[model samples]
Target: MNSRQIKLTVSYLSILLISCVSGTHYLFSVYSISIQERLNFSSVQINTIGSACNYGVFLGKPVLGYFVDNYGARRVCFAASILIFAGFSCLALTYEKIFPTSFLLCAFYLFWTGVASSGGAVSFLTTTAKNFSSNRGTAISIPLALLGLSAFIYSQINMHFFDDTFHFLLFIAFTAGLCMSFGSLFLVVIPAPQHVSDTIESGSNDSISRDDQRIEQTPLLNKNNSNTINRDQIELDIGGWQLLRNKDAISMILILVFFAGTGLMYINNVGIIIESLYHASATPHSDAKIKNLLGFHVSLISICSCIGRILIGPLSDIAKNYFDLSRICSLLFAGVWLFCGNLLALLWVHDIDQLWIVSTCIGLGFGVLYGVAPTTCSEYFGSRHFGFNWLVFKSLNLM
Candidate 1:
């Protein structure tokens, strides 16, 4: 392979590995019951950590993505690896009762994981999208899909490697740190060549419709051509806060909030959902049965999510390019699908046995929501300022 192609390959592989760490938030479901019992915390208390982690992720992303834009991916990723180690280490210490303030220390763990995810994810997504401008959807889908699988990866690790929950925390800290540190080294954001702008301006007039011209709207690339002209065709018309004021931007932020909120509810409560639904008490409920069921449910969600992320991105890209689909329209369809999934979860949840179907639907829907966001953001706001703009728009999820 040529040097640029090799760099792109390394970019993809690095993002995939680090993306594994980004989904550490999902592990709350698998490990929560164990953490609750050992730490003597209430269900509400443990669930709060999940919420805290979610909150921290959104809070950190805007800054982290912007930093990746202005500074560089490597420096932020290095810090991210350290945060993962420190966060998990603190969780290990807190569980051992070594920390004086247990709740505060636990909150720190949540923040650490949250911050780490943003750090890793921003770099991964931005790098991949830039490297493969032609197949932007397919490019990002690889990492995003693997990120969804991260929970499953860690669940397997927890089950096989450590009998004790505390030790598993340490393992997570070490493994995540090592992966992030190493992965960061190879993440290089190849700059868009300077002549790309002149090429797009000259080539785009025929394809852009009248309405698109009036609004200064442009497709993500030269849709009629085989090779992409993303950098040149970018919407320099609006960016930063100005783009946020646009209707598309506002709508996207709201949709993501709803989408992410729905997923978070199910994910944070998976342990309780299983216990209450299946009646998995310590005595009456078989521990083996509980573990098996819990792991199974997490895996089902992870697999569906992974597959959905892989599929929806490229599919949406095709519809947008080939069919002249509006970016917002494509997203709304995904949002509708997500809403339908949640509706089905409410309707069919007569028993725990039915929960898998519900989780599957939710996973697919969430995959669509997430996969669309960055690609859409890059298309809508322009990749030139994508990292900061995307992080800003995505902060609505935090709200």
Candidate 2:
């Protein structure tokens, strides 16, 4: 392969590693009860801590996205390494009572963890979306899928290798930090070769560089991509107030807020829901059994979500190319799943075992919704300002 191809390959793999480490926040359930029981925190405090982490995840991203867009992902990854390591280390110390136990203090640390998560995510995703314009959906989905699987990976490690919650937190800190540090070395934007005609048509300066003219003469842009949508849509560079004024952008924000909010509620509190159901059923299972079930459900959700992320990307590509359908079809399908999942959770889930059904639906729905969203934004708003636009779109989850 050529040097540019090699760079793309290395960058893709590096981003995958960073993504796997970035999602430690998804493992909140694995350690939430331990923090509560050992530190004497109430349910209200526990929920608040979860909220703090989530708020950091979404709210911190706009700034991080802006930096990633302007300064490149390397600096963002390095900064994320520091934030995640410090955040998790502080939480571990508090859990062990090495630091005085304050719920607010723990919440503060967890918030940074969330911010760190967003930093890693925004960096990798922005790089991917910018670099892989031809098959952006398939390209973005791999890392996104791995990110969904991160909670499962960590939970299994904790279950097998660490008995203490303190050690588990430390493990996440070091592993995630080191991965981001490593990824900083390779995560970079490889600019898509712009065709001069397209650039001129988009109202660029009439002047064209020698390199641009040479690339335009090559067959690079002539490759058969029957499965991809219109290239003109992909070249849109609109941003700032123009993007905000867009009716499509406004509609996306509303839809994502509703769907993402529902998914986050279930994701953040699935552990509590499982506990309540177990208790209500009057089952005589041991605490150990309950813990095992919790891990099982978390893993199950992660697995299903991973599958959904992988599936939706290529499916949407196929739909657009083969059926002349819009990406909104995928979103509608995800909405159906969310509606059914929530309905089932409310009306049908009484036993812990039956909870897997709800988990399956929600996981798949959440995965597809998120998986389709970034590419949709890039297609609709343009990858030129994707980092800022995508993150700003996601920040609506705060509502």
Candidate 3:
């Protein structure tokens, strides 16, 4: 391969590796029971720990996105490695009884895991979105698919390789740490070729069809410094209060908050749901069997989610490019899928055997929503401010 091809290859690989490890929070359901039994913790405390991780993921993003957008991703990624190692290591030590089992402390440790994951994700995703503006859908979807599969990868490793929760936690700690550390070397935004930049500038502002531009009505000014708006590519970058004030941006944020909140509610609590169903079932099963079933569901969710993320991107691109359909159409489809999942969970899925239907639907819906949301944000607000803009939507999931 030529030098440009080599750099692109290395950059994509590095981001994929980083994204794969960044989503350790998704493994919570797989390990939640083990942590509870080993730590002698109450259910509330366990839930608190899980909530801490989820909160960190959302809350940390805006700050991380700001830094990544302003200062570049390498330093943010390196810092993420340290936080991941420290947070997971401390949790592992606590699980092993090497450290005192304090509920608050445990929650605190897991919070950092969320923060690190957010930082790493923003770093790589920002790079990808900025680097591949023309093919953002396919390029961003690949790393996102790996990220969604993170739980599956780790869960399978735990089931086959490690018997102890301590070892499992340690495995995650070192593996995620090393991946982020290594990725920092090559995960960077490449400057688009001048010709490509010129084309994008002319095409985005001038050639956009009325139907294709669903989000922004007119160009927005940079509230902080009016001169910062790129005159060459009008409407390509808008940040701060101005973007937030736009009706389109507000609508997208609300939609994301609803979708992401529902998805996270199910994702974070699927373990408890599985255990409850197991207990209610007339057919008796061993604790080990129940544990295995939970792991299976987690893996199933991860697999379906990965598929959805990967599938939705190209499909959305096709819908927009060929059919001239709005990208928002994909969002509506995902919303309907999510609604069906919830409806199924409510009316049916009383039995353990029937749970997979809900898991599949929920996972696929969740993944598709996330996959399309970021791409939509970039298209609407412009890729230059995408790091901060997308994270703003992501962080609103906490609401």
Could you give the candidate ranking by TM-score, starting with the highest? Answer: 2, 3, 1
> What's the lDDT of the predicted structure labeled candidate 1?
0.77
Per-residue CA lDDT of candidate 3, range 1-399, in tens?
A: 777667888899999999899889998998888899888999999999999999889899989989998999999999999999999999999998899899788999999999999999999889888777545677788888899999999999988888888988998999999999999999877776666567556656665663234324322222453222232244457777888899889998888878777888888999999988988999786878877887898999999889999998888877766565777888888888788889999999889899999999989998898788888888778877788888888998788
Which pairs clash in the backbone of model 1?
none
- Quote the positional error of residue 21 for candidate 2 in Å: 1.1
**Cα RMSDs, all models:** 3.5, 4.4, 5.6
Misplaced by over 4 Å in model 2 are 193-234
lDDT of 2: 0.85
Q: Where's the lowest-lDDT run of ten residues in candidate 3?
A: 225-234
Model 1 residue 233 lDDT score: 53
TM-score of each: 0.89, 0.92, 0.91
Give residue 281's error in model 1 in angstroms. 9.9
* Model 2, residue pairs in steric clash: none
